[model samples]
Target: MRLLIFLIIVVPAAEISVLLLSGKTIGFIPTISFIILTGVIGAWLAKRQGLQAIKRVQEQISYGEPPGDALLDGLCVLAGGIFLLAPGFITDFTGFFLLIPAGRNIVKPLLLKIIRKMIDRNQITIYR
Candidate 1:
């Protein structure tokens, strides 16, 4: 709850400050153009990555294997796409990082650790 609140308040505040600074440093038109370009690129990357993830999931399913990793890839792609779509430089950077396979790999262990912690703490419950 506290983290959620902090993110909701701090993230926008930071984004706004960064946007203003970038606009001042690079001018409004360039900043807007960069944001638009990132959004377009992110959309394309997301679609491509998403399709690949789907293919992987389908293949895994066909082989009687769980698509857990593929689904996680899809989730990362989805999150990246969303962050890139938002009009903020920081988010665009983060989105780009998450969109790439290497970047997703970097984040995966951390994400798994958090999920494990949550499950251990009874903050998350899974049914099979």
Candidate 2:
């Protein structure tokens, strides 16, 4: 809750400041264009990665193995896509990070740790 509150206040302020600074340095048109460009690239990357994850999940299921990792990858890609769609430098950077395989791999352990904590706290329940 505290983290959420902090993000709600700090993220917008930071984004606005960054956008203003970039606009001042690069001009308004270029700044807007850059944001749009990132969004377009992120959407394309997200779709490609999401399809690959689905393929991996299908392959694992066909082999009678759990698709846990693939599912997690898909979730990350989905979240990245969402973040990319939002208009802000911070979100775009984070979105691209999650969209990239290496970046996702780097963050996966942390995400898994958080999820485990949630489960332990009974905040989340897995049915199957």
User: Highest TM-score: which candidate?
Assistant: 2
Cα lDDT of all candidates, in order?
0.91, 0.94
lDDT of 2 by residue, 15-62 (tens): 999999999999999999999999999999999999999999999999
Could you tally the backbone clashes for each prediction? 0, 0
Runs of candidate 1 exceeding 4 Å displacement = none
TM-score of each: 0.92, 0.93
* Cα RMSD, each candidate: 1.3, 1.2
Model 1 clashing-pair count: 0
Give every collision pair in model 2: none
Find the 10 residues in a row with the least total lDDT in model 2.
Answer: 5-14
lDDT score at residue 110, model 2, on the 0-100 scale: 86
> CA lDDT of 84 in candidate 1?
85
